[model samples]
Target: MKDSWRRLAERLGGRLAFQAPLRELTSFRVGGPARMLARPEDVGELQELLASARRERLPFIMLGGGSNLLFDDAGFDGLVIKLGAGFAGLEGAGSLVRAGAAAASADLLAWTVARDLGGLEGLAGLPGTVGGAVAGNAGAGPEGLGRAVTRLFVLEGDGRARSIPAADLNFAYRRLEGLPERAVILEAEFALTSRPAVEIRARLAEIRERRGGQPLGGRSAGCVFKNPPSISAGRLIDECGFKGQRVGGARVSEVHANFILAENGATASDILALIDRVRQGVLARRGLALELELKVLGPGGEVRA
Candidate 1:
């Protein structure tokens, strides 16, 4: 299987590396490695690569900026494809901003805000790539990234390109419900309100202030669990006295109960174990089982508990 993949990688590009360490790529910095890592130069290349993988019955996963991801220490056994160069631009005019999926969310938001756009202020202080944000429908307060999406250009699971309008999608909490699973977002167009640049900056400043307690610069996936309908996950964890809890090199952030920090030598197992403990504690004490917002990918493409 390794030999077969090596030959295919050669046809695609040599930049594809084997046994690539994923720890440094993630905000958590605790994953082991990817068996075969591939970066597509453009959408065409990505399409061809996917077609080949499907033909070979080789499973492949899309990896964005790796901010909201957690991989097992045993490492992924399938191909990992990361979009590059071609998917790294943000451009539009008037009240519409089009951003490539691989574009950094912060850069894209900053670009729109600088141009006096108002709708994206809700996502100003979040991390990860535009694709990751869109896939997860990440948001703050009552606003989600899906609300501003006007259209999406994506590569469907069967390697067909599609242009879908936001009205056709189900914009729910932390998910784009109607979109097909494994659809690769190439670019997205966001509808924004035209406002004074000063006003947008002020709103962004307010958001930053609100996220001040998030342990922004730490090596941890931001906000580990999704907020339940009744109360916030952080508040529940804090109420359960889960803050400052440490399991090996992983520690629940004292500043924010939802964040689990990974020290230099921390393993993915440590983080996974800590997450289970938090969930168990929350369920046992509050009778409420919190769902995870973060994507936990295991070795065989399964989800870890």
Candidate 2:
């Protein structure tokens, strides 16, 4: 059956739409078309869209800047809701920075450093939006976005908005396990200490310099494998001799094996194959099963195992 969404979206006059390409929204620049992609101009419009989707019993997924995601070549087959400029502003008070979920995480870091707010210097170069970072507890060792987040405003499954403490939210290594699927992160407030602006900026710069040795940029879903306890994923992949391994246009990054780099025109299937190859090699050599750090969005709204 044809979905009733297009007609409804058209009636809204560009507030939402259908069959949007996932490649452009994702950092990997791969994947196929989403069944529907809605850009709500405001919270009211978003609420309206959600209400409609719920009434129709249609599936929907919220997306930010789409970093840290590995979309299948076959893409998603459900509504992909993205909040744009209407939800991407930031404000601050003494030791607090409140940001809209859609606000770019990089912008938040820059703003914090400019204001002499300390504690997130280690996340200087991480890409994607604040909401995704908060959801994933994004960070390097000893510090993550969750640590700074004091409060989060979430639109829960029942369509009620609730304010919650970060500690109350379920956040673990690269995943928020217990949040209801229908919940849409609206905004968050983070705590930071006042510091010398110059010092904070310098520390951010140092992080950037340190991360320079790793492969970033190009079409990638960031780190492909989660670090196992007491060891790094990159080091293990390198040890398995899978660096520079290629299948079609997807290859394990020679610079950092844990990261898979897609040459132009690569498909998500290619990357998936490479991921399997890396895992097999690592498992065979070390008898350890490596878990994924990136979320893989698959076709027909099917959950990827």
Instruction: Give the best candidate by lDDT.
Output: 1
Model 2 bad stretches (over 4 Å): 1-7
- Model 1, runs deviating above 4 Å: 1-4
Q: For residues 65-173, write the lDDT of model 2, one tens digit per residue.
A: 8888776777777788888788898999888989999988889888888788998775688888888988788886534667677888888856778888876776677
- Which ten residues in a row are the worst by lDDT in model 2? 1-10
Estimate the TM-score of every prediction.
Answer: 0.96, 0.94
lDDT of 1: 0.86
Relative to the true structure, how large is the alpha-carbon lDDT of every model?
A: 0.86, 0.81
lDDT of 1 by residue, 1-305 (tens): 55656676787667588888888788998887888788887877787777767877777788888988999998888778888867989998888889999998999888987787888887888888899899888877745888999999999978999999998887777867777777888999999999999888888898889899799888998888988998989999999999999889999999999999998788989998999999999999999988988899989787643
For each of the candidates, the C-alpha root-mean-square deviation to the true structure, in angstroms, is 1.5, 1.8
Model 1 alpha-carbon miss at residue 2, Å: 6.1
